[model samples]
Target: MALNPNVPANQEQRTDEIDLFELFSGLWAQKWLIVGCSALALLVATAYAFLATPYYEVHSILRTTQLKELDELNGTGVYKIDPEEALRRVGASLDSYETRVSFFNANRELFEPLKKGSGSLENAFAAFNEEQFTLLQPDPRKTSLVPFVGLKLEYPADVDGVAILNGMVRQAISDEKVRIAQDLEGVIKSRLNVINRQLTAARAKYEASKENKIAGLKEGDEIKRAQLQDELKALRGELRLRRQSRITQLDEAIAIARSLGIVKPTTPTSMGQDAGAAQGNIIRTEVFNQQFPLYFMGSEALEAERNGLLKRRSDDHTEPRIAKIQHELQLLENNRQIQFMQSREDEDLFLAALADLREESSRLENIKLDLSQLQLARVDRPAIEPIKPIKPIKMTIMALGVVLGGMLGVFAALLRVILRRKANALA
Candidate 1:
């Protein structure tokens, strides 16, 4: 029983070997079919390679502008746009779909090929962005390399991609320049408005201050004049009372003198002695502890003094302070400082900051830069016509076709062998 088990194993191994041999022999018989299919596929691929539409790729590179190139723009105080920012703006404009559409619409003749077979202008342009136009930039992960942005356009041999790329770049630069100029103008206008407002306020403040000063001066003058008038009135009243008291004392003393029969002025010693006994016309005065009465003078003299006091026209002339007050009031009638300020034709002279504001405004107003000369971005490399088509490679397509054809032929050969085996078993 053991010897019989080893013999069955040997027979199964021999059957597997025979089956492998038959499979190889069947595939070898179908070698011509595989070769024929491969040849047919290669021919079709060759024909397609020569007949298919070839697209050419054109590229233009843009770099940041040089510092010296933007000197005028940077020098302008109102607005400053740097080279990197300018380059970024241009790149943004180039990357915009709207910008691409605008360029396409403007140069319809140049883009006539894109419109072909496309449903509408929108669809054609949309397809154009997806297939033909490409926005390129340096790798962000690589920091050591100089940053640059590029525009790539792939077009058929019938279209001119070079002209389109160059035109777009120039248009983007021109648009950015216009935007910078407008921004500068807007800033200058806003600053000018602020300066004008400040100047107006300063003038108003100056005029108001001048009027206030004039009013204060007038008020001060009135107060001073009033004080002088009060002092002068009090002095005049005191003088009038003193003069009236003297007149009353003189009247009483005159009656006393008339009762004593003393007509001329006499001293107390004379009143005791006889006036007729007096030698010569020389008058004798005695020093006494008491003050001499006003009646010491003759009646005629006292009457003359009283009459002069009553007939006096003005007391202001007698007081020095009254004359000084009148002089000060006359000066206040026309203040030189107030007149100078009021008559000033140029108020900016007094306002030191106004001149500076005006100068700044004038500088901004006179700002003139040749925007056409400004360079928004530098064209590192201009677009050039492609030397070769970037389409379906003939060699690659033919190779793939050969491989696929061989695969199909082998499957057909296997299926035929299996069907023959089943038919044989049925028969």
Candidate 2:
């Protein structure tokens, strides 16, 4: 041990080389075992590649609907659905578990493979949905890309994947159409109900106003008639009093004319009644004036007026206001405005905007939307039958098997060599 301090560096290098050579010799001795393991692994990989069930992948691309395809829906103005929204709805349906289950149930013949397992049909479908179905969409951050949504499905080669994917897309479009149509119908019905209620209210209001107007007319007519009757009665009473008074004045004038022995209208001078001048009485009083009393108009004229007044049967024609009152009362017998309102047959005419509303409703009712050919989303690429299986890549599996066999062979060889040396040293 003390003499090892003087050993050259070259000697240590030779010792390391010998140890590496021994390691190579030990691996060469178990070459047959390593070959056997590699061959066995390669056999298993080849068998699996040929016997395993091959899976096929099918994909479809969906784009937003075009504006021209949605003309009928957008033209209505009352209800509208956008292209982006329609595409989004289809994508959502594709991602829905319920939608997938419904499709599965409706077309059970297509999903027969999922029923082969020991688990229930629902569990199989859940597994299939989780593993086999994929939803693809453009990344929001990728601005240069045209936005699109797609469905990817990987299924056993025996299944008709193309039919399944295309059918599902068609079903989603049909369902969206139905939903839009129902929404439109519901809105129209609600609007129609509101319009009908408004019409009823308008009719009721018109009837109330008509009744109020009729009542007011009747009241006014009664008041005017009563006032006219009162005025007529007052005029008649005044006429009667004037006639009686004239008769009394005529009687007095007659008495005075008879007592003076006057028979006709005459001046006092003409009758020589100026006694102050006839008796030569210069200082005697003399009355000089033109107008005289009603009696002075002469007893013959007064008696004639008194007899005419007494003979009068009515004084209605004497007052001009009485004739006017009677005419107004006749006019009030029936109000023309109220009559016009009551005699009308159509209550709808009372509502100002009723005609316009009816026209709008009729237009909406007549609206013809042909959704049989409505396109909710555009199919950029339809699913096609795949020619090759995407799983169990044969060349890659075989290569991995060779590498794994080599590793396992080397580990066994090293362990055997170490164990054999220890046993030899013990002996």
**Top model number, TM-score:** 1
- Candidate 1 stretches greater than 4 Å from native: 1-18, 269-276, 279-291, 343-346
Would you list the clashing residue pairs of candidate 2?
A: none
Task: Write the residue-wise lDDT of candidate 1 on 299-328 in tens digits.
Answer: 666667767767877666666776776776
User: Model 2, which residues run further than 4 Å from truth?
Assistant: 1-21, 219-223, 226-292, 297-304, 307-313
Worst 10 residues of 1 by lDDT: 11-20
lDDT winner: 2
* Candidate 2 structure quality by residue, lDDT tens digits, 1-427: 2224555667645543436667678889999888888888888888888888888899999998788898888888778778888788888888877778778889878777677747777787778889999998887777735567899999987788899998887777677777788888888788878878887787788788888988988888889889978887887898788778778988898777667666677556545756454455334444876555555556677777778878889877887987887888788787798788889998787778789878877877887787878898999999998888898788888888888888888888877877775565345
Q: Which residue pairs in candidate 1 have backbone atoms (N, alpha carbon, C) closer than 3 angstroms, thus clashing?
A: none
Q: What lDDT does model 2 reach?
A: 0.79
